[model samples]
Target chain A: MARRRGERVTRWLVGGPPGAFLLLFFLLPSLIMIVASFRYPGEFGGLAPLFPAGPGEEGGLTTENYRVFFSDWIYFQIFLKSFGVAAFTTLVCLLMAYPIALLIARSPHQRRDLMVLLVVLPFASNFLVRVYAWMIILGPFDLLFTRSAVILGLVYVHLPFMVLPLYTNLEKHDPVLLDAAQDLGATGWSRFWRVTFPLSLPGIFSGSALVFIPVLGVFAIPEILGGIHDWLVGNMIKEAFLGVRDWPFGSMLSLMLTVCVLAVAGAAAWLAARGLQRA
Target chain B: MRRAALAIEALAIGLLFWSFFSDARYALAGAALAALGAAAALGAFGQRRELPHFWLWFASILVYAFLYLPLAIVVIFSFNDSKLAAEWVGFTTSWYAKLLADVDMLAAARNSVLIALTASAVATVLGTMAGIAMHRYKPRLLPFMVLTPVAMPEILLGVSLLIFFLNTARPALALFGIEFDLGVLTVIIAHITFCIGFVAIIVRARLAGMDESIFEAARDLGATPWETFRRVTLPLIMPGVIAGALMAFTLSIDDFVITFFTSGVGTKTLPLEIYTMIKVAVTPEVNAVSTLLMLLTLGMIVVAGRVAPDVLRGK
Candidate 1:
């Protein structure tokens, strides 16, 4: 009984503060944004109060914010563009990162560790600084503030994301399988195609998802390198809240973005589940 | 087959060097550097019997060059004597001097440091406790709860926090006779909110790896829970905690999006200030500032890696 009481006290002492802090600051703000999405935009800027101004039977709730988002062809185009950019970035990252990850995974122990560190070393620097670095590199090519620049920046910034997961996954692959395949008189290419690639699909999917989701919300790179016209959903959301002062619209957009992210995660999880079952 | 492979490798390396010389005056120098690196890479490849693939080595070298090219450009331009950032007009240290003398930039740096220090300290404690609790208690919801901030887009979190402070937090604070404005305090709050998750993830990994027997031994030796935690648990996890704290500090100092949303008048952090500077023009001064910031963060990561190498690997 004493031990049970002690455990309860320790649990509360340990878990209580962080849980409450997250609830108040993290979760509550998200909840408020959701509530704000249901309201109208105020004149000039900001969100209108959720409650009606007058004391009557009139309700202030409206779906117009979401309606505006769904009805606009321009918004749809931007969303599609964002998705395309993210997909392209993911594809490019995967292609570029795969061989590098494999090389790192297969190298001598010390060299492999060093190569992995080299991949992660970039993260030690500021992301904005790295994007700024790209700005200088893209300057002479007449590519500054262009779509290509943004794509290039996204690939550069997110290469580690694709590489790390692929490395982790490839590291876990059994080397004995390769020997077995070769022992069966299979050539190197055939062995890899038959065994190695199939086993690394989970890693490929995960790395793609990792690169894709973040690339969808890449505002900094786009804003720095791609100019205003190349704005993604992330840039749009930022403009809505900070630039345009349209909180209701911003909140609605935020909700949609969250939904899109959730959908991506759900799909990835489903695919991973299926892949695991097949394996 | 060997000759064909060698031809392809030679052609690829020659094209790589040729492409560098296509644009800037420094391109030839860059090409020369690439040649030197290729030679080194070839030498290393020959020495390593385990690595049988030359094309793989070549491709990996190209990727490394790609990764470091921008950073190298930034560092090189910081020493450029000319006003044009992209051009190399002999080396000079004037930009670094100019960066040191900038008053407003210094203030922003100070603010960034203050915020990072305070936020990381608070986050480290909370995260360590939460990590311990999650590990020891096995709370069902803890994983999702901690990971939400990490998984959410920064802009989403920033805008949400912005809306909250403006609409809810300010009014709530005003009711208690405290003036609430979005400034340094709000930025710190926003930082801590996001930073907690990184710390929690690192600390949790460390906690999970901890030897269960040590704790059992402590208990058997008549050490009370608090005493055990104070000596055994804290010492065992100190490296993880320090690593977590260093990561939080680096992140808080370097954060831009969330800070941009949450900052009001006179609350420009280093990244925010750097963004403003870059938006105006690409000057050598900006490069100098960025180089300094990069050094600081790299130093912190080195320290963190020393404390616990696995912290970086998310082990």
Candidate 2:
């Protein structure tokens, strides 16, 4: 009984502060945002009050914001474009990162550590500054305000995300299997195809997810690199809240984005689970 | 095969070296180097039985160039005589001097450092306590709840926090007869919110690997629970705590989106200032500031790497 009481006290002391803070700050705000999404935008910009006086109230509660988003062809196109950019970035990053990861994985232990350190070092730098560097590199040409520029920036910023995970996965892989396959008359290409690539699928999935999700929601990269001509969902959300003051629309979009993100997350989890089960 | 591999290596390295001095028009030479290096590495690896893959070494070198190019450009331009980032007339440190003279830039940087320091300190305490409790108590579903912030998009978190401050926090504070507003305080709170997860995960990883027998040995020595914790547990996990604190500090300093949304009027952070600066024009002064920020960040990560290499390894 004493031990039980002690454990209870410990739990409260340990979990109470963080739990309460997140509940108040993180979870509660999200619930309020979701609720606000169902409401209408306030007149003259900004979010409307929750539980407004009546239907006549400016930006009162309504589902119209979501309806407008779903109905608008422009919004759909923007969403599609955002998805395309993210997918393209992930694909490019995967292709580029694989060789780096393989090279690092094959290095001596000390060199491997140094290589991984170098990869992570760039990521530790200011994200805005890195994108700014791209702006300088690509800006002189006519490439600054284009979708290609946006894709290039996305790939540049996110390549490390893909490489790190792939490297980790590759580093843990048993090299003896490759040798075994080689002894069994498997050629180099066939060895990778038959043995190495299959084992690295989990890393590929994780890297893709990591790259795709951030690229999907990235605002500054697109805004700064792609300029005003190319806007992703991140920019759309930013404009809705800060620029347009259409909180209702922003909320609706946020809700949709949350759903899309959750769907991607759920699918990844499902795939990982299936992979685990098979193993 | 050996001769071909060596030739590819030499060509790739030669192009990479030549690209630096050939001016901005030949910047594509860097890209060419990258491509040739990749192909050479592939070719060498495809025939590994005959000769070693020496060209793979050049491929790794080019990959480093790709990763470091932006930072290198920023640092290089900071010393350029011309105000334009692309042009390189002669080397000058005037931009660094200009950055030092800019009061607004200094003020923004001061604000960033202050907020990051306070946030990291608070997060370390909260996260360390939570880490200890979680290991000792093993609360159900709490770990998952804590990790939610790390998984969510920054924009979503920023937006939600903005709304929360406006709609929930302010109104609630008003009920208590206090005025509440968004500024440094709000940004700090948001930093702590996100930072707690990182600290907790890192500390927890350290705790998981700790030998439980040490704690028992303390207990057997008739040490009080607090004394055991102080002498044994605290010392054991000090590296993790420091690592987590460094990460939180670095993240908070580099953060822009969350800070942008949370910062009210007159609360500009460094990233916000840099963004505004770039949006107007890409001055050499901005390059100097960016280069400094990059150096500070890399320095911190290097220190953190030394303290807890495994923390960086994502173990």
Candidate 3:
């Protein structure tokens, strides 16, 4: 009994440092951000008292920052624009990825390997490089400054993320299932809709989530490829904190983005659960 | 039926060839011929039990072109010699030589190497610990803790860290009679913060796959917990730790968005340097630098693949 107790104690001692480290660094920074968001910025961007004073006070607990974001049409427009870009990017990636993924899944082994390498090679390069490559192709022809360019860049950057998962899921699907569907007198469309599409949903969901979440917070693509009108919420937050030095407002925006991302993720999880239940 | 399809496909191929080599009119003729041939082939093949294999082959080529053409252009242009930057100049190694001699590029390269090595090492240790603790202890806040760093957007994390330093740390350091400029140290800290999550996730995955009986067996053999961990568990998880470390290194070296937000005026990493150059225009010099970076990353990924192909093999 004593030996086992001593072993448990040793395990705790061995494991204690990591847990404490994460708590201090990861958890603590986020906690500080949340607290700072609620408080006002002090002299020269320092943290002021938690609650400053009443309306018109130099430093006070005010919901004005939050209210400004919510009440203003511009902030909402930026939010919508970011959402729209993410959605469009996701859709384009799905369109481009599905056919390629299908082809990869169906190809002979050597060819499939080559295709997979091609897909992963671009992905392994710096994300900025790939985006810059697009800028080169699109610029001087009035293409870089367009909204479509931003979407194209996003889709290009994320295509592998979408394709890899989809290809894996599709590759695992039994050929016999499709054969059986065809033998049952189903047409090509029916076979795809009934057999292939349903089996690929998990990959589709995961890929979309992976692409959508990051693209939502994409900072550089729009900044580089987009004109003045194409700035995302990410750019807005960056500008607020870095350019304008508005910490409270930036914090508020960050909090809003976090809430929105969680809400979308929750919705996705709920939808996925419903789908599994139906299945 | 097969003969007709083959004949039409050949005609289409001939037309495409002529279009590329001949005048605009011939090109148009070629495209029309190819389109008609393809349509007829699809129509005929659609009636058969098996869908046309030609469609698959054609689609595959198109997909490959889409994925590779841009990269091909960049790689090709990197060898160009003209200052025009757009038109294909004669191929030369001068740009590469220039890249070698560029002081700023070399400094950025050195900084990238330093940051990647230091950040990967620090993140590996911390991440391995976190992974083990999460696996062994099952802490109540583990999920939230892991998700906090992973889920928060890069911009948010960057700005938050910036705020944390400026608001909290800067003044406190001044009171200690030390003036700290946000330099290499700040960049390294940021890289470590982000890299930790990546390492933790990879290592955690490896830990999940590990059998619990090994540790139990070690205990049964009268080994102390530390001895068991040192002797048995460490060897088993070393691959995972190394894999995580490689990932952290790649992420740190490739990172631009976070580094941009946190790095000071003087601490220019390679990605940041390339980004600024790109903001002006796509120079052949930038392309040369990019090609080198791409080669390095590809080499690292190949090594990583050999080390842990299973991690990347599945979804």
Candidate 4:
């Protein structure tokens, strides 16, 4: 009985603080954001008040924020454009990541770590510095504030994300299978196309997801690199919260974005699992 | 195959020098650097035994070059003597001198250091507890709460936390919020919130590889739980704890977006200051500061890797 009490105390001592911190800092904020989305904007800005100040005061509750978001075509177009950019970026990251990931995986066993580190080294710098690197390079040739520049910045910052997952998946692949395919008179191209590519589907899916989701909500790359017309959902969300001080609308946009992200993550998890099972 | 590779190499060498002469200097320089890298890659791959195809070698080198050449350009341009120096007139360290002299930038750097040190210290403690708790106690909800923040888009956290701080610190923000350093504390909280997960992940990964029997042995040998942890688990996980601290510090210092959302008027971190500078003008001083920031983070990573290599691997 004493030992049981001790165990209980130990559990609380070890786990209680972080659990409480996350609840206050992470969980509560998320819940508040959800609730905030359903509320009305304040007179000056932000949300008016969720609870009544006095007895007769009406609560700040409404579906108008959602209604405004859904009824708007411009917002939908921007969301679509962001998704389109994310898809394109993911595709490009996959293509760029594959060659390096494959090479790293196929490298002489002792050299693999060094090769992987090389791939990750540049990314260790500040994120904005990496973005700024492109500004200097892209400033010339009239490409600084353009769609291609935004795409390029996204691809550069995110390439390592795609590469790491793809490399891990590729590294796990058995070389014996490749030798078996070759022993049966499979040409190099055919061997890769038939066996290697199919086996890497899980990696590709994951890499794509890793590249896709963040690009969807990134405001910085667009804010810094792209022209005025390239505002994504993130840029809009920022405008609502800080610029316009419309906390309700910002919460609404954030909630929608969170839902979209969770859905994509779920789909990726399902697809990756299926791919793993088949492989 | 050799002929084709050589043909590619000659073309690249030609372009590398040609781009230096071209009016659209930087863009062509990037292409030329990619080409030169591809050429060197061919020579290196040619000597390897039983490697991938020459085309693979060619393509992979170009990709690596793409990854690196822009930063190289930034570093190279920082030394150029002119403000809008399209061509290198002479090498100078004036930009670095200018960066040192900038008062606002210096203040931002100081604030960044203060925040990173405090946030990382707190995060390391919380994250270490969470790591040990999950490893030993196996709490289900703790893991999810710890990791979800790390996994979600940073902007989600930023905007949500903006609302959160505004609500929690409403009295302070109630007025104009001019004099209050509310954004600093809030940004610190925000940093710790996101950073805890990474530290936990690294610590947990470190713990996963240890021998479970050791903890059992310490327990059986009449060691109290606290004594066992201090004498055994703590020492073993020291590298991870240190690595986690360094990683958290680096992350806290470099963070911009979440900071951008949460920071008040007076709270200017280095990234925020650099951002405002970038918006104001594209100067070589920005390049100089960026080069320095890269060095700082890189040095930290090297130290982290020395203590705990797996932390560098995102484990």
Top candidate, metric TM-score:
2
**Model 2 spans with C-alpha error above 4 angstroms:** B1-24, B27-58
Taking all chains together, each candidate's TM-score versus the true structure is: 0.92, 0.93, 0.88, 0.93
Which pairs clash inside model 1?
Answer: none
lDDT of 3: 0.77
Model 4 off-target regions past 4 Å? A52-59, B1-51, B171-181
Instruction: Give a tens-digit lDDT track for model 1, residues A1-279.
Output: 998899799898998888888888898999999999988787768876667778863337799887888788999898899999999999999989988998888887777767888888876788888888888767876889888899999999889989998898888888999999999999878987898888888888888888888888768788889876678999889888878888888899888888888888788778876766675
Off by over 4 Å in 3: A1-15, A41-57, A106-115, A174-176, B1-57
Q: Which ten residues in a row have the lowest lDDT in candidate 1 chain B?
A: B1-10
Candidate 3 residue-wise lDDT, A1-279, digit = tens: 998788578656745665565665556666677776766766665466565566655565667778788788999998998999888899889888888888889887767766777777778888887887777666534577888888988888888888887898788888999899999999888988988988888778777877888888888889888887578989988887777777888888888888888877776667666654654
lDDT (10s digit) by residue, model 3, range B213-278? 988999898887778879998888888888889989998999887788778778999999988887
Q: What class would a CAPRI assessor give candidate 4's docking?
A: medium
**Residue-level lDDT for B292 in candidate 2:** 94
User: For candidate 4, what is the interface RMSD?
Assistant: 1.4
Best candidate, lDDT-wise?
A: 4
Which tens-of-lDDT digit does each residue in B22-97 have in candidate 2?
4755665667667576656656556556544444455565677778876777788788899676556798988898
**Residue B205 lDDT in candidate 2:** 84
User: Residue A196 error for model 2, in Å?
Assistant: 0.7
Question: A157, model 3: CA deviation in Å?
Answer: 0.7
lDDT of 4 by residue, A1-279 (tens): 987899899999989999999999899989989999998777778777777688876556899988898998998898889889999999999999998899888888888888888888898888888888888766656788999999999999999999999998999999999999999999888999999998999999888888899998999899999998679999999899888898888999999899889988899999999999989
The model with the greater TM-score, 1 or 3, is 1
Give the top-scoring candidate (DockQ).
4
Give lDDT per model, in order: 0.83, 0.82, 0.77, 0.86
